[model samples]
Target chain A: MQRPYNFSAGPAAMPVEVLQQAAAEMLDWHGSGMSVMEMSHRGKEFMSIIETAEADLRELLAVPPNFRILFMQGGGLGENAIVPLNLSRGGVVDFVVTGSWSQKSFKEARKFCDPHLAASNEADCHTRLPAPGSWQLSPDAQYVHLCSNETIHGVELHELPDLKALGSNAPLVIDFSSHVASRTVDWRRVGLAFGGAQKNLGPAGVTLVVVREDLLGHALSICPSAFDYKTVADNGSMYNTPPTYGIYMAGLTFQWLKRQSEGNLRGIAAMEHRNMAKAELLYGFIDQSSFYVNKVATDCRSRMNVPFFLRDESRNEAFLAGAKAAGLLQLKGHKSVGGMRASLYNAMPLEGVQALVAYMRDFEQKLA
Target chain B: MQRPYNFSAGPAAMPVEVLQQAAAEMLDWHGSGMSVMEMSHRGKEFMSIIETAEADLRELLAVPPNFRILFMQGGGLGENAIVPLNLSRGGVVDFVVTGSWSQKSFKEARKFCDPHLAASNEADCHTRLPAPGSWQLSPDAQYVHLCSNETIHGVELHELPDLKALGSNAPLVIDFSSHVASRTVDWRRVGLAFGGAQKNLGPAGVTLVVVREDLLGHALSICPSAFDYKTVADNGSMYNTPPTYGIYMAGLTFQWLKRQSEGNLRGIAAMEHRNMAKAELLYGFIDQSSFYVNKVATDCRSRMNVPFFLRDESRNEAFLAGAKAAGLLQLKGHKSVGGMRASLYNAMPLEGVQALVAYMRDFEQKLA
Candidate 1:
């Protein structure tokens, strides 16, 4: 079967190996005479699947014991409400809008709390993160919120802000939707991080919420039990019936991540290395070509999602068609910002980036 | 591979054929060169998947043009809060609680509005639905709610009540989680019908909401945009990135249902016939046996979930083990209501029921 390199910014590509393994096990998961989808979430069979997935994820991210990992639904947008409901304490909340995602989060939080804009890059058309030092954090803020990566605008925070260093005692909350699992997270600086799994993990429904334990019990009285962090943690994320099939696929993907090897390093260390290589390959090609340009500032550009536009703006359709012919898919950018975006997540191999670069170079030559 | 028949209420069993097909398509769906999980929700490929799934569901349920179909996250419990937030309009709401789910809905709705329990079976341990004539629905009730099938108590409303006939023009909302696609729905009487796909359709994470056009714009000011039906409906359920993989699987299951035939009867008609036969075979065996008892009222017993108690409660372990050995699995009832529960949803075939019956008889004979 002719398979293409997919670079869509989420519900994005997953490891092909993970999919193959899942397919092989779909009829009977590990010889249990039931598909993982068919097994009870409470049954030992499914419990094992969940446990391993969580454990592998913990190891990959080096998650601290004081934090809880929750598999949730409703993606990052859902969490815009859920985060404030759980953390805002119905008081003041601080937000730093780096791009489209945090802007959305800030707007959503206004419904639940007294949201104060700590910083914003809206004037710059969301092409870069506002420097952490410039954020005007609220002294009474329940938590300080920011987007670590904006999938739509291709802006990323290479290093998370230290809220304590910035004279804010409020826990730092980051919407890390686009780049989770692609690189290491510094839990010391993070009180909570959430992302939709569609980007770097598995699917749309299974969202990952990693929050510090101390921040768990403060959900608003208006919060639904299913969306309440304390209830979900206490129930082992089964306060409501979870997205079981998505969890299963994610578990397989986790196992695949653990088994990945690159020379002396393995697992996420290898993943980080590979992601760096893929990002460099694509970004290098873009920088070298006069026919293409990426708009993000150099210091904070996302390594996962790279948005570029053709120099000849009218040739966008032709570029996309040529890329499609070369077995490259989903080159379309966010509609709000008309361009091409190549999202090279943890699942995108260096080889896939090589193929993408090769296609870009060929297309540029034809256009010239 | 050893595979056990799963019978959990929701997040329940999936058809083996569907699982096999999903597995086969997992790596590269229809040679698109990406798993369904990997496709961008907004791309042409995934839009096709979403549209096809929606169309298949619309066809299977014969949902009218005036009704909007929303694919959402959150299970029935989340909907408990979301329903009131969207439909309560700060007015009084009425509930007819025959079982656990509706009771939970009522309690949650109390947080948002003045929810009056119009009718209840708590006095009777929820064995039957309260008669419509006995319901004291509020004159100013914004909406009247009911659980069409209570998964835990195994009680079902075989025919829905007409609220207008009961002197209330309030819309009727039904939670059809356990038996959504197992039988036909009378859309004429239902202003909204919400269900989690885990029971009879596909997996958890995908909740189906069919709401009439009139109920579209009544969301409370504080309702989260993600949970607002009007926002969801207006965006064609793309207000947020939908549970893409779950919808795809549910769509495939819908297609499977469409192709189903038992001597020329197809789709919901065939499912109804099969469901009746399966329910009868198990219930008939329980009725005749001295070692088994089902306490639900005959008129209101759920065809999908059969809760039965072994005459000798001490032999429950032996019964489950013996049943497992005989390839009949997950017959254990819910912990809240102890005993064995055989959830014969749309996916459970007549052969599975026959095997369960034969196993029951064998176990009972051994006891004798």
Candidate 2:
């Protein structure tokens, strides 16, 4: 028997092994006689859980020695304010409005800093990413904000832009919420990276923040102590009681990711290989079929979230119903962009994408 | 078999039934072929879970229609700063510092408002609550902050202070993290009530905020859109991607709490009755035993957390080791104030209290 593939962009699908382990240990974790949720954050049991989770994540991402990984509570939306509050210094900051997530970050940063438009792909209807060389980098910008993958727009920056090469001395802050761990990150090009854990990492409550140690301690006075990177780092994200159960779930996910293997690849490298194949399979089918059309540019199409529209929109309801019957779930796209989307996160197997493509193909043939 | 009676306090013990149900539904929830963690917050399945949870909570608490219930992230510590950011209006806010939690809230509020220490029990080592008559009511205060139950010091406000009788119009804001849903609330006297869901609720990530409708739209400009009470209320706590799993776990716990019964009482009334019995059982044992002592004044002792000390501190290790061996776990006191502490949350059955009493009796006999 197979479980239906869930395609939620976030609070997204999780690996079956992770879910199995979580279910198996739901009552007691490692013979501790208490569930992960029941353990105090300050207790040795929970401390080990969080510490191991951090170490595993750091290893999984090959996080630099200078970087500190924090397990925080608020999602990517909360980090919009937190990032500016910590890094912006109430000074000029550059924003590349690539899509909805970055656009929201740019807008939210306005309250705390002077967010200057570095570049925008809005003119292209966010179907493409602005060329890195075209950004009007701010001379005195505290940081440059970008969403590495725009979940809604189905656009992703395959490679991070090097700020120093672009004549900006500022740090590059990326919100990689939808696509974190799907591919390797180039630390040299990134000063800080944050993501909500729902999509690729684990669950929704936990937000992962990996920042260069040098970027710490410059938080604005108004920044809440719990949200202050320095405070969180200082206390190891236990400044406030952390999301214990969520961290435990993420730890299980990290372990599962660690066990993943591909031909000549392991861990994140394997995930990247698998994700690339899944994306190619889905996007390849969509590009070839006359019934389907993906609006995003070829180079910028997100490997995680692939949004597409049916040529005949009237058949959308019947298509979705048939897909459900075929065990393909949550094919409905975001309301902001009314169509269909299939998120191929780290937990999404190639077989799931194959099934989706098959379902789409069947639906299209039935129409003929 | 009875599991170890865990008493670490917040992120404390959950109802076994909730854990069992969560485990059963880990792979697929109600035949949706998706775990609660995997469901999109906007999806019908998750929406139903959250809605039903809210409805049940309102019925259990008898919350007024005028007060909006918000499922938020960031624990009580985060709310220390958030409460002021939303409600203070940069004006003076009166704080009654009874213990560590309120004291922390008062200091955090300093960044957003002129936080006035209207009262403090630190002089008494937080062993007693300052009378309402003694509180210096700030004439132009925005709100009055207090921790209804001091988890660490084991002091609780048995009855809410009537600010009107005390000659103040400022709405009372209570941090009920350690005691929420364990007992009833008098909403008429409270303008806002916030608590981390780790204790009486379910998990660590979700924070519960119940605020009067009139208090909406007052967030400071610097408030993060996700943290803004108005924005969160408007979007129904989906302003940012909420802690979906935490909320689901809490929903499960809420359902479990709703099924509680004690004699003629049900729900919160049942919990209050059970909690009172558990507290009495432990406190009564401690008070009668010459070897053990609880410092807090009897009239103000916390019904949830009972902090006690042995006359001979040298036997602390032995006492703790014996307790753990006897299936009593996490009875160690907080590092800031050490000795021993037992938290009897709603899930802590009276039998668990009896076992603790039995352990204490046997330990005291060894000394004789």
Candidate 3:
């Protein structure tokens, strides 16, 4: 049976194989006579599960040994507050507002620190990226934060900026929620990277944080102990029951990513290659058609979430109904941006994008 | 095929039926063609899920209309800081420390508020409850906090204290993580009740917060917006992505609880009767035996978690091994307290506890 290709921004689709494996092991995980959800966090079984998950995630991301991987709760919005609480230290912080997510982060940080907007693409309607060289970095800023990929506006930073070259000593923090594990990350340029697992990882309950060791112990006194980077690292993310089942599912996804192969490339490399191909196919079709147009600049277009609009806005409902009939689901754009969005995350195959393009062409022909 | 009887304290055993239903629906839920984990939290499918779960839980607990049930993350320990951040108003808060859980709560809250120890059972090594009358009610205290059931020390408050009756009008905040849904709560006496769903509800990621409507919005500026009670309540727990799959599993558990029957009783009342019977059988055996003993006072003993010790310390390993071989699992006590614990949660049938008692008897006789 063919499954529908889901296009929701997030809590998004997961690998079919992972879902099947989890179903098979739902009652008894490896003869333990308990589901993964039923095992105690401190039990040897769950300990192994979390340990393996951390190890696999580290391997997939090529996370440096100096970085600690902590599994936590609360999505990106929660981290918007938690980040400032831990890193802000009631001092000045720098932000590069590229889209809706960074705008939120900027607003939330005001509660904990002096947040300054270093650069913004709002003047360009978030269709282009603000040049890193143009950013006015604070000399004593604790960290410079940005969303690596904006799910809403379909804009992505293909390469991270080197803060040292930009004359800033502050560490770079990236909210990688939308595109983590979809490609390789340059950890050398990062002080911390956090993402909600719902988008590209596994489920909605868990948030993954990879922070540098030196950046760990500086959490402000007001930070919740469970969210204190130093405390979470010290307890191995077990400081407050670390979303056991979500961690388990993320572990499965990491294993799935490891097994992915494309020609000579494998693992994250293979995924990146496949993602590029899928993005190219969909975006190419949209750009060539007069009926469909993506507003984001070509150089900064997101390789994961592709947002486009129909020239004939009157056919929005009809397009969605036809898409659903063709098993292309959740194609509606965010309310704030009225159009259509197709998020091609790690789980979305090349064929799914092909099917979407095919459906779009067929719909346009019918209208003609 | 026989399944092992698991006694893990939290992240404990779920009803086999719930697990089976979750497994069967793992790939597609109600013809939605998407796993619960894959559905968007804002989508109609997940909205229905969270709504139904809240309604069912409220119905089961007979929750007053004035109380808002907020599905959150970060567990009970997370609530330690969250509770004070939202309610303490940076002023004095009183605590009645009964065991290890409440002790942790007291320590974490000091970071956010002026925490006063109104009463403590630590002098008795958490074996008994401090009488409500003996509590030093603070005239200007924001709220008085206590753990309804201490999972580690096996101490429980059978009845919630009325602060007004105790000559204090401060709201009573109870951490009922271990005993929620196991028995009915007197909402009239509670200002707020919070619990990690891992214990009696479902999984670890989702924390259930049933708060009085009037207590909705007093979050400290430092509180993470995702965790602010008012922000969460106003957004219907969608201020951030909620633990979607956990909420769904909790919904299944609520249904399972509703279907429970014991003699003439039904639902939570039925589970309470069965829980009482299970506790009596196990505690009766331990109290009557020469080889085993429970240290908690009889009047305050936990019906959910019963911790006991082997009279002969040398037989601890043997007892645990034998229990495992006899299809009994996770009977080891928390490391802080050296002994054994058999948590008879809502999922543990009366037969599981009976089997545990039978195994203890046979082990004791063999040693003799």
Candidate 4:
């Protein structure tokens, strides 16, 4: 059966191959009598599954030796409070409000620590990234937080800000949920990075946290033992049953990613090149057309999520209906952002973009 | 292919029918052209999935209308702290420590509230339940906490203690992770009941929280918004990106549970009847045998988790190997309690228990 190209912002599209593999192994994973979901997390079968998943993710992302990859529950929002509870120590923390996600992070941080806004793109209605040099560096900040990519507003940070260069001695933390494996990460500049797996990764339920080793033991006395980074890391993400099925699915995704090759690039590097190409195709078509508008600044536009608006606001429902008829799905934008959004994650093929652009153009011409 | 009988405590076994259905729907669920994993939580497809799951569970458990069912992340361990943060209000809370799970719950709750030990079976090494009349219920306690089924030590509170009858004004909170859906719950006696889906429900990541409407608000100021019961209840468990896939899988399990029947009984009642029969068959066999012994008192023994030891400790390896050879897997006991454990959750059939008993009897004869 021909599956429609799903453009959901999250719980978004996944590689068809990943789904097929998971389906095939859903009953018995690799000759084990039990399904991945039914296996004990501490059992050797599942231990190998989690270990391989963590190792493959580390390799794919080029995660450093100094970092511990802890598989946790609670998505990015949960981490907003958990991060401060672990690292902030009720001290001053700097936040750059890029869009909805980072804005939330700043607010949740207020519960356990003193959060200071360093910069905000809300001044420009989140159409552009706030300049790193313009940020107000907190000299005594425990850590600086920012959303690397805004799924709703379609904003991306092409380059990470250097805290040391910005005259801040604090470690840098980024909520990279929307665009994690789509690009390479520079580990030297980041103290902690967290993302929900529902978007670019395999599935929801399992959260990925890559934190520097030095950041482990600073969790507050009130931190839940399950959410405490030190306990999770010390127990190898098995302090509790570590979302066994989610990890297994993610492991299969990592394997699929490893086999991906584009020219000389492989794995995440390959995904990065393909994602950029897909983004360029959609954005170029929109830029050349008078019927569509993408308001985000060109230099900072997200490569994963491309939010566009039809010139005629009256035609929004028709566009969605037509898009669905053409086998393109989940194109409606977030309620907060009134427009159409097409998330071109790692799994969104270049052909999917071509199909979406074709559908949009045909709809525009038909109305014209 | 014939599958083995798995006996892992939590994340133990599931109905074969559920696994088969999940595998079939992993690619395209109900012709939605997207896996349940790929559907947005707010989208109609997933909304229907969660809503149906919730409704079915409500029917199966006969949950009262005044209670709210929350689909959350972070397992039961996470809830140990979350329950206190939401209910304790930083005041005195009563805990009845029965075994490993309740012990952990007690320790984690200490971080947020003044935990008063109302009752304990630790002196008996968790071999029996503490009598309700003997409990030291605090007059000013905000809530009384206990584990309905202790997975590790093979102890269970068959009948929920009546806090009102005990002259405690506090509400009763029960952690029912290991035996949820296997038996009927007395909602009149329970203020809140929480469990992870890994054992009797579905997968590991999603947690089931049934909280009374009156207990909705009053989270500690330090509580993470994602973990706040009121916030989660208000958002329909979508204040953050919930464990979408886990919920979907659990929804399938609920449907599977609803179809279950035994003689004149149906659903949870049917499960209760079948579980009692299964437990009796295994326990009766153990009682008749000279080579095996179950430590927990018969009145307080868990129907789900039956922990037993061989007459000779030196034959533990031989027994496990022989059981494995006979298609009985993961029968080795928890490291904390050194003996074999057979967890007969709802998914475990009469045949599986019969197979386990047969293996034990044969192993005993061979050694003798």
Candidate 5:
């Protein structure tokens, strides 16, 4: 059966191969006589699963030796509180609010620490980035937080700001939920990076936290042991079960990632190239057409989530129905922002985007 | 192929029917073109899934009208601190320490509030529960905490203690991870109950929180919004993106539970009967033999997790291998307490228990 191209913002479409492999191994994983979900986290079979997953993710992302990868529960929202609980120590923290996610992070952190909005783009409907030069760096801030990619608003940070270069000694924390693994991470400028695995990784319920070695043991006394980054890192994410099945599927994805090749690039490098092509295919058609428009600035637009509005709003439901009939799914934008969002994650092949663009043109011609 | 009778404490074995249903629905759920994992949590499809799962569980447990069921992330370990974060209010709280899980709970709760040990069975290596009448209840205690079943020590509170009857005005909180769904809960005696789904329910990532309506709004300022019961309950477990696939599998298990019928009993009523029989089979066999022993008192022995020691400890490895060859898996006890634990949850059939007992007898005969 031909499945529609799933464009969900999260718990999103996984690679077809990953799903197939997972389904094949649903009852027994590699002759272990138990599904990965059924194996004890401490058992050797599951230990190997977690270890290989962590290793592959480290390799795919080129994670630094000085950083630790901890698999945790609680998606990005849970981390909004967990991050502050672990790092704040009741000190002031600065935030550069780019879009909804970082804005939510700042608000949630206020309950645990003194959160100061160092910069924001709410004045412009979050279409552009706040110039980094204008950020007010707090001298005593525990960390400066930002969302590298805004899943809802379709804003992406093409380059990370080095806090040291900005004359701030605080470690930079980025919520890279939507665009993780689609592009390279500048780890040197980051103290901690966290993302829910749903969007670009494998599934929900598994959260990935990459924290610098120096930031390890400063969790406040009130931090939950399972959410405590230090405890999780120390226990190898077995601090509490570690979402065994999700890790196994993600491990399969990482293995798939390692084998992804495009042009002169391979692995994540190849994935980034293919993602760029897919985004170019969809956005180029939108830019050249009179019937559709993308509001985000060219330089700051997200490659993963592309939100576009139809020239005639009355055609929305009809367009969605036609899109569904044509084998496209979950393209509806977030409720807070009404439009259409085509999230072309690492899983959406270039052909899928080409088909979408072709359908859009044919539909536009019919409307004309 | 015949599957093994797995005995891992948690991330434990599930009902085979649940696995089959999950596999069948791996691509499409009902007539929806998306897998449950692919559905938006707010969308109609996933909402129906959550509502059905909640309703089935409510029916199975006979939960009262005033209780709110919250499907959350972070396992029991996360709840160790989350419970105090939400209920402790930085006020005095009393804990009845019985075994490893409760001891960990007490230690983590100390980080959030002044958690005093009102009673303890540590003096007897957690072999017995302290007499309820002897506990020195704190007058201003926020709540009195206890593990209804100590998964590690194989001890259970066959009868829940009533705080009012014991001269305490505080509410009672129970962690019922290893035995939830296998028996019934007395909601009149519980203020809040939480457990990870890996054991009796479904998978590792989903944590079930059933809180009293009156206990909703008292979370400390230090609580993360995601872990805060009020925020979670109000949003219908979508304050954050939930573990979608985990919820789907749990929903399947709930259906399995609801359809269960044995003799004149049905559903959870039937589950309790089968659990009693399974526990009796294994324990009765162990009791009749000189080669094995279970230390917990017969009145307090866990119907779900039965921890037993071989008469000769030197043959432990050989016993495990023999059991594995006989299609009984993961019978080894927790590393902290070296012995064998056979957790016969709702998922384990009486025949599985009989198979385990037969294997145990065969191994003992061979050793002789």
Candidate 6:
């Protein structure tokens, strides 16, 4: 049976094969006589599962040797506070706000440190990115924060900026919740990168944190020990029970990623190539059509989340109802930003985007 | 096929039925065309899931209208810091350290509040609980904390102490991680009760917090908003994308708990009766056998986790190997406490305990 294509921003679609394998092994994982969910976190079975998951994720991302991959609970929003708690050290922190998520991070960090607005695309209504060279870097800033992809506003930083070249020696922190694994990350420019697994990873429960080695052990005294990077790293993210099932599912996803191939590309590279195609297909059609439009700047448009508006806003409900009828789901835009959004995450195949574009054309012609 | 009996301390064994149901619905939950893991937390499908789960759990626990049930991430250890950050107000908070879990809570709480040890079992090696009468309650203490069941030390507080009767009106905070659903809680005496779902509920990603309404809002400035009880309660734990799949699995476990029956008893009461029977059978055999011994005080011995040691210390490895061969897994005790621990959680059938006893008898005979 064909599954409906899902376009929700997060807790989104997973690879069908990964879900099937998880279902098949839910009762007894590799004849261990226990589901991955039922294994003790400290037991050899689960320890091996977590270790392999971390290692596979490392290989998939080519994470640097000095980076520590910490599997944690609480999504990107939770990390908003946890990051400042660990890195801010009650000092000045700079934020380059591109959209809603970075705005939230900046606001939340104010409770922990001196959060400075280094640059903001809010002046343009978050439809574009502020060039890195235009950013106002704090001379005493401990770190600079940005959201690489805004799931809601549909803006993405395709390339990470070199902070030293941008006249700041501070570490850069990126909230890559929506676009992680859909593309490559430049680790040399990143001090820490965190994302909720709900988008491109696997599920909602696990949050992935990859932090540079030197950034560890600097958590504020009030930081929850479970979320303390040094503590989490020291214990291999088992300082508390590390979202056992979520990690296992994400491991399956990492394995699925490894098996992916598109022409000469494989793994993350393959995903990036496919994601670009899917985004370009949908955006190309929208750009050509008179009935629908995406307003984000061409250079900063997100490949994962595509927010579009119909020329006549009265057709919004009808658009959603028709999309549902056409086996498309969750196309409604975020409540904060009214319209429609089609999130083309790593798992969303090119065929799904083609189907969406075809449906849009059909609807437009009918309306005309 | 017969599944092996598991005896791990936590992230322990679950009911075979729960695993089977989860597997069956993994790809498509109730024809929603989405796995529970993939459902948007705010979408109708997941809202129904969380609401039903909360309702069923409230029904099972007989939670009062004045108390709010929160589904959160961050296990019990995370709560160690969160509880104080929300409740302590940086004031003098009292702790009754029964064992390792409570001791850790006390230590973590010191970061957020002036933690005062009102009572401690450490001098006695955590083998017994310090009586309520012996506790030195502080006049200005904000709350008194204790682990109702020490998962590591195999001790339990069968009944919570009334702080009011002891001349202190501080709310009683119980970490019931190891035995939450095994029996009913006296909500009147409990201002708050929190536990990680991995023990009796389901998976490791979700933490359950049932707090009195009056205890709602007063979090420290440094508290992460996601971990703030007021924010969590006000948003019905949707402040951050909750551990969606974990909540769903835990909902399944709650449903399983509701379906359970024991003669005239049902639900939590039924599990309590069955748990008592299982505990008595295992402890009875151990007490009668000269080959093994359990060191915890008889009155406070945990019905869920029974830690015992063979008199012959050199045979620990052989004992574990034999137990594994007999399809009893993870019987090895906590690293801090070297002994075999058989946890008889709600899911463990009486037959599993009988099988364990029979294995123990055979092992003793072989040693002889």
The CA lDDT at A164 in model 1 is 95
**TM value for model 2:** 0.99
Q: What is the docking quality class of candidate 2? A: high
User: Residues A105-207, candidate 3, lDDT per residue (tens digit)?
Assistant: 9999999999999999999999999999999999999999999999999999999999999999999999999999999999999999999999889999999
Model 6, residue A3: distance off in Å is 1.1
User: TM-scores across all candidates?
Assistant: 0.98, 0.99, 0.99, 0.99, 0.98, 0.99
lDDT by residue for model 2 (A145-261), tens: 999999999999998998999999999999999999999999999999999999998889999999999999999999999999999999999999999989999999999999999
| Residue pair clashes in candidate 2 | none
Query: What is the Cα-based TM-score of model 5?
Result: 0.98
> Which prediction has the highest lDDT against the true structure?
3
Model 1 accuracy (lDDT, Cα): 0.89
lDDT at position B48, candidate 1: 94
lDDT of each: 0.89, 0.94, 0.95, 0.92, 0.90, 0.94
Give residue B34's lDDT in candidate 6 (0 to 100).
86
Model 4 stretches with alpha carbons more than 4 Å out: none
Model 4: per-residue Cα lDDT over B57-174, one tens digit each: 9999999999999999899999999999999999999999999999999999989999999899999999999999999999999999999999999998889988899999899999
User: What is the total number of backbone clashes in candidate 5?
Assistant: 0
Q: Model 1, range B75-97, lDDT digits (tens) per residue?
A: 89889999999999978999999
Cα lDDT tens digits for candidate 4, A1-368:
56899999898889999999888988888888888888888889999998999999999999999999999999999999989999999899999998999999999998899999999999899999989999998889999998999999999999888888889889999999999999999888999999999888889888899999999999989999999999999999999888888888888889999999999999999999999999999999999999999999999999999999998889999899989988999999999998899999998999999999899889988978
Please state the error at residue A347 of candidate 3 in Å: 0.5
In the order shown, the candidates' DockQ scores are 0.79, 0.89, 0.87, 0.88, 0.76, 0.84
* Candidate 6: CAPRI quality band: high
Task: Provide the TM-score of the second chain in candidate 4.
Answer: 0.99
| Alpha-carbon runs more than 4 Å astray in model 1 | B1-4
User: Under CAPRI classification, how is model 5 graded?
Assistant: medium
